[model samples]
Target: MKNTPIGRLRLIGLLEGISYLVLLFIAMPLKYFAGFPVAVSISGALHGLLFVLFCLAILHVMFVHRWSIFRGFWAFVSSLIPFGTFVLDKQLRREEA
Candidate 1:
């Protein structure tokens, strides 16, 4: 899947989504309820790195596919919402097929 621009974007988006979820559900809870600030520190850093990669992947795909600005904007917006990337994955998979 990594051979093509869309494929790479999908893979990075999935990873970024999972990292965001981990940071939100596990790391944040650990920081607040379990008195483990390190959990957030680690997961937050991972999520941040993945998010930057995701942005770069989006740009790569946008340029390769000639996506409309609105489509690119939607892609960026999807990264902000929980589970949004999974939903975006469905659309991307259709495009891939």
Candidate 2:
């Protein structure tokens, strides 16, 4: 997985998506409901970094694979929604295979 560009990006995307879900369902709730802002701070920072890396990976894969602009755009958009990366990654795997 680490040796291939698309595989690396797919892994990163999955991690980023998991982090996003954690931030949304766990960290944010802990902050707002339990008066624990620290969780959000930590989760938010990690998610931000992961999100940036995922975006860069998307760009790299798009360029290297000569993917359409629309495909790249949708990949970026997919990261914004819950479980979106998993869906996009599945479709991408089919396309690649």
Candidate 1 displacement at residue 50 in angstroms: 0.5
Candidate 2 residues 19-87, lDDT tens each?
999999999999999999999999999999999999999999998998899999999999999999999
Work out the TM-score per prediction. 0.97, 0.94
- Give candidate 1 misplaced runs (Cα > 4 Å): none
Indicate which candidate wins on lDDT. Answer: 1
What's the residue-level lDDT of 82 in candidate 1? 96
Off by over 4 Å in 2: none
Clashing pairs in 2: none
True-structure lDDT of candidate 2: 0.91
Tell me the TM-score of model 2.
Answer: 0.94
- Encode model 1's per-residue lDDT on 1-97: one tens digit a residue: 5468889889999999999999999999999999999999999999999999999989998999999999998998899999999999899999998
Residue 46 CA error for candidate 1 (Å)? 0.6
Top-TM-score structure, candidate number: 1
How far out, in Å, is residue 2 in model 1? Answer: 5.1
